[model samples]
Each structure stands twice: as C-alpha cells, then as structure tokens.
Target chain A: MVRFENVGMRYGLGPEVLRDISFHLQPGSFHFLTGPTGAGKSSLLKLLALSHRPSRGLITLFNKEVSSLARDDLPAMRRKIGVVFQDFRLLDHLSALENVALPLKIAGAKNSQIYQHVAELLEWVGLGRQVDAKPPTLSGGEKQRVAIARAVINRPQLLIADEPTGSMDAEMGLRLMYLFQELNKIGTTVVVATHDLGLIKRFGNPVMFLKDGMLTTRKQDELPSQFSRDGG
Target chain B: MMQIIGKSAELQLEKDVSTRYLPVVIAAMIFLAALAIGGLFSLSNAISDWSATLTGNLTVEIAFDPTADLDKKVTDAVELLSKTPGVAAARAIEQEETLKLLEPFLGRNAALGDLPIPRLIEVIIDEDSAIDLAALNEKLGEAVAGARLDIHRPWLDKMVLLGRSVQILAAAIMLLIGAVTVIIVIFAVRTGLIMHAEVIQVLHLIGARDQYIAEQFQNYFARLSFLGALPGLIVAIIVMFIFNFLVGSLEASMLPPLSLGVEGIIALLLLPLMVALLTRFTVRRVVLGSLERMM
Candidate 1:
C-alpha cells in the first residue's frame, strides 16, 4: 500500500516536477498509471518504488512513513516491492535464470528453492528454453520476460511495472497482463505505468491518470474480458 | 557447463574498462613495494652482521714513539697488550696490511716510501673481560710510549645510524606507495561504480543491500590484488636473488652479499595476501561510502 499527500518532488533545486500531489493505493488494488511522455510517470513510479524522497509532504508505503524511515531500513522495506523496469534492466553478464534468481538470492533463499522457483517462473514467462541465455543474446521480448520474472519471483507484496508490455508482441503482452492479473488475484498490489491504451482498454482495470504532475483516478469503461484470464 | 552455484557480483563488473586494468596496476605496485621491503631487510641483516664482527675489538695504535723503528714500537705494544689481564690475544699488523687499510684514503698504487704511518696492533679482547679503560691506557702508555687504545665506538655508532636511517627511509617509501595504491583503488572503484550505475539502480529497486552491491566490487578487486601481487612478489624474489647472485659472483670482500632473513622473506612471501586484504578493505570502504552518498 502506498499513500502520498501533498507530495512535491524536484531534483536538487530544480523547479518541482510533481507539485501538490496526493493519492493513496489500497492493498491488493490493481491500477494502470497513464501519462504522455515527460508527464512525470517515471518520476512518480520512482517515488512509489522508494528510490527517491518527496521534497515536500508526507509519503507512506505499507503503513510506514517513508520520509521518516532511516536510510538503512529502506532496503528491507524494498524487498517487499518488486519493479519491472522499462528498459528490462536484467544484468547483461547474468543468464536468464540467474537474473530471475537474483531477488531470491538477495533474500537469502536456499539454493534448491531458488532454482525450482526461478526455473518454473521463467518457463511460465515463455523463457523455458532460454534459461541459460544471457541478456545480450536474448531478443527484446525475451529480456522483458526475464525482467518481469525477476520482479515477481519473490512474490513481493507490491508489484510495479513501467511499460511492461512495450517490447513484446500482442499475444505475449496479453499473456503477461494476465500474469499480472493472476498475481493481483493472489493479493499483490500492482501499479503499471504505461501509454499502452489498447492493452489498458482490453484489460479494463481502474486507471490512475497523471498530467503535469497532478493525478486523477478513474474506473475504465468495461470492455470484453477476452484477455482477462483471472476473471477480474 | 558452469559448475559454480551462482554468478557473483564481481562478474557483473568483469567487463568494465577500469576493472580490466586493475590487476596489472595492483601487480606493478606490489612488485615495487616488495623490492623496497626486501632491500631494507637485506641492509639491516648486513648491518647486524657487520656490527657483530666489529664490536668486541680493541685496537692499540702507536700515537707517537721515541724510537724511529715503527716495527719495534708495534712489537712493544703487542707484548704489553698480550700481558694485559683482559687481553685475549695481541699481534702486530704487518706493514703491508697497515698500508692495505690505508689504501682507501691513499691511492691504490700510491708510493709508500716516505709516507709517515703509525704502527697498528690489533687487540682481541676476552668476551667477559672487565678491563678498566683508563687503567689500560695508562699501562699501555707506560710500557710502550704513545700507545692509544681505540674502542671503535665512533665507527659503530655511524654504522648503527646508517642502518636506522635506511630502515626509516624504506618504511617511508613503502607508506607513500601504500597511499598511492589506496588512491588508485579508490579511483578504480568509483569508475567501476559509474560503469555499473544502471545495473545498480535495478538492484537497488530489488532491495539489494549496500553491502551486497559493495561485495561485488570488493571481491573483484581482492581477487585482482591477489593475482597481481603474486607475480609481482615472485618477480621481486627472482630479481633480488639474481642481484645477490651477481654480488656474490663479483667475489668482492668489501661489498656484502644482499639477502633477506627468515622474517623478511616471510613478509615478502605474504605480499599477495596482504595486498588482497588491502584491496578488499579499500574497495569496501570506498564503495559503501559512495553508495551511502548516492542512495
């Protein structure tokens, strides 16, 4: 769960990027964050991901006031939140399996558990045969799946994806969206930042729209749930 | 077929430009440092050997003698010193041997025809001898005119001072090299961090601890330090052995052969381990501090 009230953010003496902003995300709620380019979508995601502090106002994550938390305690809090980057930030030197297993390793999971879970997740993401492939050798969609598997491998309480479907084909994108839906069904709060309106309309989730750093929430006009595998 | 359990963080940095060059830098630094330390130890050992030989020697020289025959004056001095209670043995040095001792101040082939030279008598003192110096001088002057007792304190003090200065200078040089090594490692670590910044952001989002990120850098550098320092130490050992061999090959009596004692050799042998530890600590501190600032 994330709550921001009157939050204003800027990068070091610059004009505020997000001004007088406020929103609260309920536990297990799924929302699509929509904005045009440079609409501070990534910046908003950054703040939610605990990467940056709000320059003004109170920001809370999982009931703990983030701005008041000590810097050392941030990492433990972060392990509960998983992020899929727009660039598919899988380590270039690591294989698909290793990349997916990274969060589990960081969490100090046993070797057998990591191998079994990571292998099963990678297979589910359509990377079953490319487990040993490094990121450089993998296609864009393959790398995206690897990144997504890495994000959800730990089953973090909060799952965030930036442009999760950007580099993938329609079938794979819908499948991945269902994956997110399936995760949300199991009680993981999801906030996906994207400009993909077709996927947004098809999935028909509640939308959080941001323009000029101000945010508004809306429930999408319900569409046919053809791509919805989890029956939202 | 990789046998290792999982990829370590260091491998993440394996391709960076700065990381690629780190091993060579560490090797070169350790090489030079080992040679300096080895040279210092050799000098100390040589000085100790010299001190052991030079001390416990009492020399009796004829300051002035009424008799014109230098040989007769040397003979009387030797006889009186031989009878002295604390004297173990006294012998008159031959004129040629006396001239050989003067060969450094006087030219090697300089004519010795009219050169006024004092008669020299070497006195070997008993190990437990408790002879009173004033009494010995009085007895020597009475028995053999103008006989002077030389304790060689000035020469011994100079040797000790020279030994101490070389040790201090070598130590200072090592410290300076160590400081430079730390600086180089710091720069390397910073550059490595820059190279891995993108990956680090992802890792950070995944809740990787600062220590987890730092260990990747630390392990890489520590390995480089060890790998680099071993060859450097080996090269130093070989070069020093060759240098000592060359000195020994000269068969020169005046120049002592360079060699390290057991302790010095052990220290030199441990250079790889020491460098590894230094690299690990330096990298860990720099990386943690840098990450703390960045985060």
Candidate 2:
C-alpha cells in the first residue's frame, strides 16, 4: 500500500535531512519506524502523510505516485490516510467531540451523522465523559486520545502515528498500541514512528530504522536489546 | 451567543487581536466613500436643474440713461419682442422687482430709485422654435438703444464646468477609498493567516480543502466590512440631512440642499452589501493564493 524509492528530502535549500530512503510495505502490513533525535523520523513520516514532497525519487501511496499527483487531488488522498501528530495537534478551542468530528465535517457529512459517529468514536477512545472538554482542559493522555479519535474517525485506509504513546502512561501506551494493532488487522496499513525500544520489541512488527538521513529495514528481532532514548 | 459577521469557526478568527479593529478601519473608509458618493450624486442633480431652468430663457437689459424716457423704451422693447416669431412672451420687469433682486447685494438701506440701474425685460422663447440669439440681440440693440440679450450661456457654462470638475474629484476620492479599503483588508487577512498558520497546517493535514479554510477567512472579514460600512453609511446620511437643514434655514442661500434622487438612494443603501462582497472576494483570493504555496 506504500512505497518509497531512494527518497531524499530537505527543507528550503538546506542539506538533505533524509537521503536514499527506500522502503515498501504491502497492504495491511504494520511497521515501526525508529531513529535517534535529528535522524529524520518525523521527516519520513511527513512524506508518508502527504505533508511534504520528497526532493528526489519516487513515493507511491495507495498505488499512485505522490510526485505526479495534482494539488487538487492531495486532499482526497490525504483523507484516505490518517496522521496522529507527535504533539497531538488538536485544536485547543474545540471540544473533544468537535475535534474528532472535524474530518467528517470537512468531508461535508450531514450534521446528525457527524455528531453520532464522533460520539461513538470518542466513547471508544475512552473520552465519552470528556466529549465536551476542550483540549486545554484535558490531560495530555486525554488529548492524545482525542487526536487518535480524530485520525481514525474517517476509517482511513492508512494510519500513521508519530510517538503515539509519548505522552501517556505505560499501560495507556500499551492499550493504544493494541488499538493500532486492531486497526491494522482490518486491512489498514500502519506505520508508527517512535524511539521507544521496549514498545518496538513488545509490538514485534517489522522495523524501518533510520539514521543520519539513511534508512534500513529489518525484522523486529534483529533490533538491539538496549539503546539510548535519543536512539543512539 | 450571536454569530458575528464572517466568523471563522475552525480557525477561531473571532478571537484574533490582529483583526479586532478592522471594522473600525473599514467604517472610516466607508464614511469617506459615502460622503464622496453624496457629493457626486448631488452635483449631478444640481447641474441638471441649472440646465433645465436656464435653457431657452433669455434676459434683455436696457441700459439706464438719465436723459432717456426709460418707461417708453421698455414699452417699445416689449412690443417688438412680442411681434417676433419664436418669442413666446415678453414682459418688462417692474423696477421694484429688479430692485428686490438686488436687495441682498445692494442692501435694503440704499435709495434704489435715485440710483442709475438698468431696466430688465424677461423673455420666454418657444420650446420647438430655433431662434438665432445673436441675430435677435443685434435687432434688439438697433431698435432700442443699448438693449442687450443675455442668454446666461457663458455663466451657466462656467457653473457646469465647475460642477463637473467637483464630480470628477469626488469620483477619484471614491476610487481612492475603495483602494485603501482593499489594502487594509489584505493586510488584516495576511496577519490572520500568519497568526493561525499552525492551525491551518493542522487543518490541511487533516484533509480540509483550501476552499474550506478560505471560506472562514472570507466570511469573517466580509462580516467586519459589512458591519463597518453600516455605521459609516448611517452617519453620512445624517450629516447630509443636517447640511440640507442648515441650507434650508438660510434666507437666500446659494448652496443647494443635498437631494439624492432614486438612483443615489439605492446606491447608498447597497454600500454595506457591496463592501461585504468586496471583502469576501478579496479575502478568498489572498487566502487561496497563500494556501497554494503550502502542501
């Protein structure tokens, strides 16, 4: 469902932050992307989420080449791929329910249909009681849940999470990982970017390790048992 | 809560400090614009009135001479003018009436009868007939000594020219107001975009179309312009009415009252809506263009 061949990226004439990054994942396959700080993990995720263009090489998402896609077609492609930001980019003024309902509302779904589905999803994400709570009023974990709900609201064909468990407790992190697993089981391709080795080992998904603007794919068992929090 | 004009729901633009005073700026711009419109339309109507009243009308002035019988001269001039074809009617203006016309300039205290003043005759020409004013003037001068035909053409021409110049100036002021308003709105919208850039990126990544984001900015700014235009328009109308009242109170005022006919009234009423639409279109273009540079 996703492919990247020798993709190189830089920011506005800067040196390449990601270089010669080549990888591919079959439909419904899940992968963990791990790298040290400044190793371009977020940049790679950005390319996958259709947030930025690769400076060189090919990126195919859902069988269509990304570079060749028209700007007008980007939104529809974006709608099919869900992204959970590392910062949990939920609008602070919006209630949890409203934040979750954004994708549906933007897609022009009827009001009644939007609220009903958003309420159900918020409940599933354990935010039913906090549905009316704004992001500022919610705890970090609660905010993360709201962001996750927003991402999955549209039942996107691909789901990408950047440090999905970074702000949550260990148990909460495990639960959210299980949620990702459940989504993956239903034919949604999942790529989770994290520096947490323990989570990587526990999930035991295929690994795409990035370092110094380069990428390497390996089985989860091939990962070192210990590594610094910075991915050293 | 009441929905404000052009509220950006997703961006929460209603809370931005950057655009908080946009309505006030728009109000000031619209105020000047409305006054310009008032002057433009008022001058147009006044010019039409002057042309209508002066056309086909002539004035005959018989120069005063102490040795001449002014009454007999007036009687002969009236008879000759009446006998001429294309002359509707000719009546000698009474000496008392002529003195009354000079009352404002000469003052009521003057001994008007002792003063040497020209005797004037009013001439009405047939609407359908073409009279050679130059030929008629020569005939009147030959028949009665020192009699002259004054069609008021030169004076009316100068007045019309002055009126038209003022109209052009008013139109230029209107165009300047419109340009200033657009620039102000452009700056305000750009600031709003910058302030809300993070949220905009979030929206875009979440699959919100550029048009969806643009709609919020357009709607919010349009509302500001509309609300601002209303008070400006209201104040202009009030000022116009007060000016007309002051003009009407004068005994022999040369100033005409502000009288906007049907077209002017309709234009005044549509100012708010037109400004709102302009704001909408401008905001949309700026936002969509800015968004195009994004992913």
Candidate 3:
C-alpha cells in the first residue's frame, strides 16, 4: 500500500538523513525495520506517517502521490495510517480512554460510539481498568499500551509503530506483537521499527535494515545468528 | 460533543500560567471600548436634540439704549415679526424672566435692575413655510433700531461641530481598543501554540485536522473574552449611570446625561458577544496560520 523511490530527506539546509531510500509495502504485509541509533528510522516513519515532506523523490500511499497531495487532503489520508510513537506522546491531561478516543473524535465519530470503541480497545490492550487514569499516573508500559490503543482505534489501513515493544516486558511485548499480527491478517500493512534484534528474530517478519541513511532488505533466514542489537 | 466556547480539552490551556491573567487584560480593554461607545452614542443623541430644538426657531434681541424706550422697541419688533410671512407667533420675553435666565452666570442675589439688560422677543416660524430671515432682520432693524434676529445658527453650528469632533474621537478610541484586544489575543494564542507544540504535533500525526485543533484554541479564548467582556460592560454601564446621576444633581449643569438611545443600548448589550466572536475569529486565524507552518 506504500511505495518510496529515491526519497531523500533533510532538516532545513542540513545534510540528508535518509538518502536514496526505496521500498514498497504490499497490502496486508508485515515488516520489521531495524537500524542503529540516529540511522534515520524515525525520519522514515515520519514520512510514512505523512508528518514531513521528503527533500526529493516520490512517495505514493494508497495509489496517491504523497508529494502531490494537497494539504486539505492530508488529514483524510492520515486517518488511514496509524502511527505509534516511541515516546507514547499521550496527552498528559487526558485520561487513557480520552487519549485513545482522540482519533475517533477527530474523525467526527459520535461520542457514544467513540467511548464504547475506545473502552473495548483499551481493554484489549490490558488497560481496561486504567481507562480513567491519565498518562502522568500510568507506568511506562501502560502508557505504551495506551498509545498503541490510540493508534489502532480507527482500524487504519497502514500501521507504523516506532519501537512499539521497547518499554514492555517480553510477554506483554509478544502479546502486543500478536495484536499487530492480527491487524495484519485483517489487511493492515504493518511496519515496526525497533533496535531489538531478539524480538525481530522471534517475529520472523521480513526485515528492512537501515544504516547510515541507506536501506537494505533481507528475509528472516538471511540475518546472521550473531547480529547485534546495536545493528552491527 | 464539541462546544463552541469551552475548555481546551487536549491542550489543557486552562491550567497554563501564561494566560491566567489574559481575561483581566481583555476586561480592561473592553471597559475602555464600552466607554467609548457610550460617548459616541451620547454625543450623537445630544447633537440630534440640539438640532431639533434650534431649527425653525428665532429670537429677536433689542439692544439696550439708555435714551431709547426699550419696552416700545420690543413692542414694535414683536408687531413687525407677527406680520411677517412664515411667522407663527411672536411674544416678548419679560425682563424678570430674562434676568432669571442669566441668574446662573449673573448671581441671583445681584442688585436688581442696575445693569442695562437688552429686551428679547421670542419668535416661532411655521414648520412648512420658508422665511427669509435676512429680509425679516432688515425690516425689523429699520422699524426698531438695534433690533436683530438671532436665528441661533452660528451657535448651533459650532456646538454640532464640537459634538461631531468628539464623536469621531470616541469612534477612533473604539477602533484602537479593538485593535489592542486583537493584538493581545494574538500574542496569547501564539504563546499557547508554542507551549502546547508537542501535543499539537502529536495530534497532527494522529490525523487531527488543523481545524480540529484550532477549534480548541478558539473556543477557549472565546470563552475568556466573553466572560471578561460581561464584567467590563456591566462596570461601564454602572459608571455611566453614576455619571448621569452626578450630572442630574448639578444645579445648572451644561453637561447632558449619558443617554444612549435605542441603538446605543442594543450595541452596549451586544458588546460581550461581539468581543467573543472577535476573539474566536482571531484565535482561529492565528492557530491555523501557525499550524500551516508545521507539517
């Protein structure tokens, strides 16, 4: 559902952080994006999330060219792409339920429908009892789950998670991964960016490895057994 | 569940220390604006009253001449004015009444009948008839020496001009207050946008349209402006009433009461709503423009 070709990005007169990045994600496909620190994984996710414009080249999402899309069209396009940020980014004043309900509320869903759907999703993310708890009152893992719940509440066509399982325990992390897989099976294209090689190995998903602003792909079997978590 | 003017839900702008006193500033601005409006409408009504009272009315003044009979001169002027076309009635003002009119300037306890006071003949013209005032004045002057027609035009014109100038000044003050309010709101909204930049970015990435976020800021700011405007308008009204009371209590005050007619009353009542709408429109523009510069 997404295609990027020769996409280069920079931050205002700076050198390109991502250069000549080319990739295509088929509908319902799931891929793990692994890279070292400052390798531009977040920048790539930003582009996928339609948060920034690439310095050069083309990006097409759901058959529409990203660069050519009008500003007014971005919100509608963004509604179809769910992004779970690394830091959670949940509004501190809003309860977990309200945070998760934001997407539906923005999409103009009825309050009755929004709260019901949000409650169900939060419950699924193991945050049912903490629905009324604000982000400041929640733990790191709880906050991460709330963030994930918020991202997928709209049932977006494409789900991009940046270090989705970084703050959680292994069991909880695997459970959230299965949630992503279930969404993938239901036809949501999934892109998970992480530095956790161990989790990547267990997932056995196709890998898109980024290093020094470049991207290279490999199957799960192609990775060396001794690959380091630092992405060396 | 979106309120037009309510708390900023996601941003939680109500708790910000930066904008805590913004309503007070807005209240002060609105207070000045309301006073300006009151002056504008009060001056307009006073000018209208002056015009209506002076138009088509004339006064015949016979100057004091120690050797001439002032009573006879007044009688002749009244007779001449009565016979003139467009003249409805002519009656000479009594000396005692004329002296009483001057009592405020020339004290009531002053020595009686010592000064050579001129005689005045009040003349009323027909509403529909056109009277040649110059021709009548010449006839009266020829028939009765030192007799002159005081049409009240020169004095009325100067008073009207002064009133209009004050009205213009009041209007300018209103415009300045409006400009100041807009600028203050812009600064507050910009600060809000800056302080909540992180939440805004998060909202944007999560598919919230710029309008959605702008509404939150607009609504919260509008609520503040509306709440602030109420007290400002009320205090202004109370001040105006107190001023009118002071004017009324004066023995012979030239100052008119703060009588804002029908339109002014309506405008005063709508001040709060107008300020709220203005804040809403301004905040929306500032938020949208700032958000456009983001992603």
lDDT of 3 at A38: 84
Q: Which residue ranges in model 2 land beyond 4 Å of their true spot? A: A229-231, B1-6, B62-88, B103-118, B125-147
By lDDT, the better pick of 1 and 2 is: 2
Off by over 4 Å in 3: A221-231, B63-73, B83-86, B99-117, B126-146
Name the candidate that leads on DockQ.
Answer: 2
Model 1, span B188-208: residue lDDT tens: 888988877877878888888
What DockQ would candidate 3 receive versus the native complex?
0.77
TM-score of chain B of each: 0.80, 0.85, 0.87
TM-score of each: 0.86, 0.91, 0.92
Error of 3 at B289 (Å): 1.1
lDDT of candidate 3 over B1-295, digit per residue (tens): 2478878888899988888888898889888998999999999999998887787678899998999988888888888888888999999999999999989887989975889888999988898787888888888889999999998999999999999999999999998999999999999999999999989988888888999999999999999999999898889999999999999999789888898999999999999999999999999999999999888
What lDDT would candidate 3 get against the real structure?
0.91
User: Chain A TM-score for each candidate, in the given order?
Assistant: 0.92, 0.97, 0.95
Interface RMSD of the candidates, in order:
1.4, 0.6, 0.8
- Rank all candidate structures by their DockQ, best first, as comma-separated numbers: 2, 3, 1
Writing each residue's lDDT as its tens digit, candidate 2 over B227-272 gives 8899988988898999999999998898888877888888889999
